[model samples]
Target: MGTEPDIILETRQLSKTFLGFTAVDSVDLKIQRGHIHALIGPNGAGKTTCFNLLTKFLEPSQGQIFFDGREITRDKPAEIARKGIIRSFQISAVFPQLTVLDNVRIALQRATGLSFHFWRSEASLRHLDGRAMELLAEVDLADFASQMTVNLPYGRKRALEIATTLAMEPSLMLLDEPTQGMGHEDVDRVTRLIKQVSAGRTILMVEHNMKVVSSIADRITVLARGAVLAEGDYAAVSNNPAVMEAYMGTTQGELEGIHA
Candidate 1:
């Protein structure tokens, strides 16, 4: 096989263009199984664009994508999702009107092929409560299980989102800025939650918070102007001149400060 068994996802010369502007250039990415891989870049570095391409929200203009040694370049979003590639958006995606546990139960319904079965009696879905509670506990949200999702604190909402994603039993979870717009306490809390939930699963995240990346990312790929600028553990990428320059005003001292 051309792909290493350890690589759960791979992109070969992946590219995306809008009109004449190249959003994501020919970039190759490989995410190792059971690792937290961070994709970081400056503003307009095409980080989100690349995530969109991987999840098949936007078809690539050129190149190929592989998931678990299988070419998925042409797979539709739902198809890839069924293949265990679950993506969580930058914003918390949950049903505000539903209880926290119910949000996760809805995702669990997919595995039972009852996702569209809203007319079913409430008892039919109660069977999912135990597993849903387990998932919520995994994210430290079990105490809020009965609370309405809309009233959850921002960080808890993100945690609930993670619990729902886990309900799908994703082999590879793509988290897009899971910690954005959070206060320091929430940032640290979610950061720990991400690490906690990453056991036995691979995570590929687009994150701007260096502290989170430094603490948990097993590998980091730095993107600049739609191209790979650096690839390494936090220590390597943070000290690279190009990566430092890409951040412009972010002095090397500041980078070093987050080097946990």
Candidate 2:
């Protein structure tokens, strides 16, 4: 018999509600190891809620979360993060006043599990600077290492955020709209950076840009209202008339309708 696929992350009957409102309802998701999975949907489709549940930001009202074969549904956010699951929000989550090197240095220190040495000279902290520089180079931000994070372009800032997150050495990274407000050029740069960063790590992203979704997603899941509308390869989703009509709109709907 063929061996069962090892699931890196799994959620069964995942759901969330606020008072009497249902944001996400009975959503089941599975993600394999070392793949880039993209979640696409219109606004108010519970994409953010899903992200929150996965990262333990909000406890699921009626579901279970498993990571690497262990249950994580009830775990605290920090506990989950320490177990190699890190998340980045839609907004830029960085120290705007700090230099690029300083930003990355702080991340490295956290990843090294050294949070108590907050007052020590980072330069003299046992290869912290060297490690920080290496991560910067990995994310193509070495050239801007000494520059203030706020001074860099939007695209560069996004890249730096990824570099900082990488310092945590996450096994799976959940990104919520990493390119939400970026212009065309910056969007393209973030896409390329995501591909480069996914070399050995698994990534789950909620993206609205169809172009970015088509370019880098190894698998796609379309969400609508509050559940999985469709899940398949690029062509399958791109050709599904219902998916196109519901999520991608009339343009994609027309194209995919014919193809379907």
Highest lDDT against the true fold, candidate: 1
lDDT of 1 by residue, 23-116 (tens): 8999999999999999998889999999999999999999999999999999999899889999975223699999998888888886778887
The runs of at least 3 residues in candidate 2 whose Cα sits more than 4 Å from the true structure, single-residue gaps closed, are: 1-5, 89-92, 253-260
Residue range 82-149, candidate 2, lDDT tens digits: 88899964222788999999887778877767744778885566577788889899889999988998
For every candidate, C-alpha RMSD to the true structure in Å: 2.1, 3.5
Query: What's the CA error at residue 16 for candidate 2, in Å?
Result: 1.0
- Residue pairs in collision within model 2: none
For all candidates in order, the CA lDDT equals 0.90, 0.83
Candidate 1 lDDT at 80 equals 90
lDDT of candidate model 1 versus the reference: 0.90
